[model samples]
Target: MILKYSNFEKSAFLTEKKFFLFYGPNFGKIESCITILKSKLNSLDRTLKFLNLFQDDFLRHSFTEIVNQNDQDDIFGNKTSLIFSLSDLRVSSEIIKLITSQDLNIQNIIFKTGPIQKGLKIRKFFEDSPDCLIVPCYEDSLLEKKEVIMRVFENENIEISLDHKNLLASLLSSERLNLLNELNKLIIYIKTTKKNISNALSILIDNNSHDLNNLVYLLASKKRNDFWNEFLKLQQTFSDEIKFINIFSKHLEKILFVKDKILLGLTPLNAMKSLRPPIFFKEEETFLSQIDLWNFQNLRKAIKELHLCQMSILNNEKSSKSRFLTLITKILDL
Candidate 1:
């Protein structure tokens, strides 16, 4: 059986089947679902034992050993809730065989994997199995995100205006963990201060705009020392490296557009004027100066470097802060 993320509930895990598969790009949601399942299982069977094992551990240990581990009887009985975070799904055949055998009496077996392709044998095995369920976790839509934010705020007895809620939703990342982290920060802020839209915006948005704008200005104008200073300050204020990369990419793209116009025989001043969204009057002079300082080649190189930095951040989150700082230093040199 297959389940959509929204439709998943703890009751689903109570079926006669012991095996469950949760797979998708949204690891946060998958983990939350697993928590709910575990909580529900524990409530129903207090004596049930919980075991967590990685795929490598499972593969390294003999099948008999795994079965024996699961089959171990406590003072009460031999019931174990097993969770396997699969590092690789290519061994799905062996996993499926082990889970299907009636000889081993495991209470519940949960398998989790990162995004699986549609044609993968492992995905098909779980989806097609009558005795197991596959739950797909996808990114939440904007409306869903808004609902989550509203629910969180409401639970805390904090009332947010629709516009403020929308703004918060726009600022939040689609990933649940990041979103929750931001929400927790905002909730704490609200609890400590005046809980109005103005206060919320002041707490969340006001501090970020100046630093971000200054960082963009410094990078575009090729002020190495100032850019590094602004970058450090912005990093302190905003911990989301991906969001910074996104803002940097947009600014670089704008510069690229202006550079293209300048290449087509337009003066930097005229090119800034020609910008579609129209540069702010106050920033137009600085924008034009940036256009004159950066050429198409440099702008393109910066964009590519920023993109690679973004990919690195996503792939290896642990070193993202250092990676981003290094990227800025490299771009400054470029």
Candidate 2:
């Protein structure tokens, strides 16, 4: 019922149980797996029929009625097999008891929705059930790295990598399913476009992403106006909660206040001293030196961009879109 294993382990684990509960924080990968399963259902058995548990008049019908439908008899009886796909698990206790207590002998797959913590709780529930085969779906963290995502971008033949940071950021940006869908769309777009491919693909695959606005503000703060402009050009559909403003405001304050008192002129060392360095930066000093070469004049442009970012936060705070921004503004000077 409750077991942890990689995607490769699924085939071997199939013999272990009949009720497969695929629960995880990462729905993107799980969704892909489901899609694959749906496609392969017929291949597994000619008489196999798939049913959407959340579809039709499911709300009106009790779980017992749902499990014992006439259509189900066609699949559940004799050589026929039933594939039950559930996106939600809010079924009544009566329905759950019916399914668990009876020897239904159906292949049930539950798609765990929501955040990782919630999915984990759902997984534990199924783990206690003796008659079900539960597979908690989670991405392999080691395989999902910046390097792997980049490889996918470079070669369409390669599968997209599930980098934890990028996946988490995408999840925070939107729902897990939506983010996964977007990433898939993005990959398709890149493949179709004739534009010169560069390391810009790297930006699309971040390990950690702040709120879109915070990301916009940070790029603007850095005077990477082109990147900021491109980001803002994205449709309103991408607007995530303004949680990053607090973090953005804090970082902006540092950008404005932190100065290299040790060095009078702009230098590689000075730039490193002034700005908060990201974790990846520590691995490469060349990036720091390039930043330092920009001189005070370019840096001032970056600061001006931050001023605009600050204004955006203030506007959001005033509109009550976010109170965090107001608190951030009060703590830091505009």
Candidate 3:
């Protein structure tokens, strides 16, 4: 019933199971889940068929073609597995109806919905299905953490020791994949240094790891900012450009309204974080704090601006009209 982001695939959904949904923005994650399902069901015959859906040209079927198969027996597992990369729930609903009408006795139907909640209805359908099993693939946490550390370690292998602060800086710049790569690089670095002593290696590793962990807080901030920037972009696309302008207008209005309300005696860092439009004053913080502030009015405005800029880029309309970028630059002084 309840599925974490990582182990959703490994759980039991194969063999006579009713319905299954492999929904998420991570294509890699959904693909991995589908691979596991295929292996479990011994559906090697249809591997090429599944791959065709991903290809541009082969994917010409409507929502009905996915759930309805010519081979009735394969409809259960050999072909019962309905894999959809569509994010539209209404479309998913139509497929579900087709599956019911065809009476495939399907073992599992893998629906890869992007990272959006609009697919909740599709999720609920599986949850409500009597014999169905619902599994959702989300972000993997431990792997992500390991990746962050590995990336920095690869580029800057600390043989002796490293300043905790500078080490943190490198980690901040590194993405999750970069961390794992860096960790392997560190192993190579250690081998080159010929430091066989366990104690020295332990100390070196601990020092770097500690700094990396500390930098996670910084990374968290950047993550929140990045999310905010993205949210603004999405909002602009879905909503009006003026909607963002109004949000920014309202936030500044609120800040001016509540400027004297909050005790300004607090530190700027703390104070800004507490404010309605608190300063995300650093580029590092802006990118790192991508997820911290979401669904906020000010964040909406920021995202809208970003969306506008992206549209401009797509249209090849060059101009200094990126209000979102301008606001971010001004806020962060970058």
Candidate 4:
């Protein structure tokens, strides 16, 4: 069975099925769904055990070992609920076979994955299976984003004006998790300081804005020392490496766009002017310097490196600061 985000709540309790596949690009929504499912399972049977197994761990260990471990019943003799965070869907055949085995001891198997392309065998298997459900999560629309912002603020008892709400919606990235984090930051600031939205924006939003832009500028201009300095400052200001990577990625995309324009016979100056959000007058010279330093090829390569750096950060959160800095240094060298 396939479910839409809106209908998930109505069907969330259909736990009779043994396999559930939550696959899509909207990681935030996927996580939210997982939380709801876990809550439901706990409510249904408090004694039910929960097992978290990543795809890598599953592949590294013998399949028999996983089955045996999960097969062990709780003190109440109830089977454990296995939550599989799948990085690759190619191993779906093995997973499907295990779940379908008549003697399997798992209460439920929840499989979470990134976007799965069409015609993939695993996707097809889930779609065709009577025992599995497939839920696809795409990016939220503008109305959905607004509703989230309003609901989050309302829950926090932080009353925001409609205009401010719209402004925040615009300022926030499309990624729901990032938007939620920013909203949490806003709520905390409001509760702690009793500050208005304007003050919150100044302190929370504008204060560190220049640091990321400056850091990207430094990287584009190949200012190794300055890049390191700004990177350190931004790290100190913002703790989330993923957020930093998102900002860096957006700036790289802008640079790529400008590079493309230049390639299409437009002067660098003309390309810069054509940017949607016009470059700040003060930063124009720096932007031009970066344009001179990086061509289209170099920008593409840098974007790829940034993506790898983001994955490294996500995979290893503890050492992300150092890992991200190293990647920035490498990009500067390139």
> Model 2: per-residue lDDT, tens digit, 1-334?
6555455344544544455555554565566556655555545666655655554456688666665663234534533333444555565355456655655645554443433344444455566777665555543332343333455455666344445435534333333455545556666665677432233244553423533543534342344554445446552334343334434444444443333432556654554455654424442353343333334454454445445555665454333333433433332222
TM-score ranking, best first: 1, 4, 2, 3
Off by over 4 Å in 4: 202-334
Better of 1 and 3 by TM-score: 1
Error of 2 at 123 (Å): 3.9
Candidate 3 lDDT, 1-334, residue by residue in tens: 3355456546654655745566654444566666777676665354323422432322575555544543245435334445656635556567667656655654455566665454376567676776666665543334344444545454555433334433332332122233344455556655777664354346655654444333333322334465455545433222123333444444434343333333446542454465544543553354323333332454445445555655664453434235544654543321
Cα RMSD, each candidate: 7.3, 11.7, 13.8, 9.1
Highest TM-score, which number? 1
All candidates: TM-score? 0.67, 0.51, 0.43, 0.63
Q: lDDT tens digits, residues 284-307, model 4?
A: 887877766766777788788788
Which prediction has more favorable TM-score, 1 or 4? 1
Q: Ten consecutive residues with minimal summed lDDT in candidate 1?
A: 231-240
For residue 49, model 1's alpha carbon misses the true position, in angstroms, by: 2.3
Prediction 3 TM-score vs. true: 0.43
Q: What residue pairs clash in candidate 4, if any at all?
A: none
Candidate 2 global CA lDDT score: 0.47
Query: How well is each residue in 228-307 modelled by candidate 1, as lDDT tens digits?
Result: 77665544234456667887788878888877887899887887788788888988888777765766787888888888
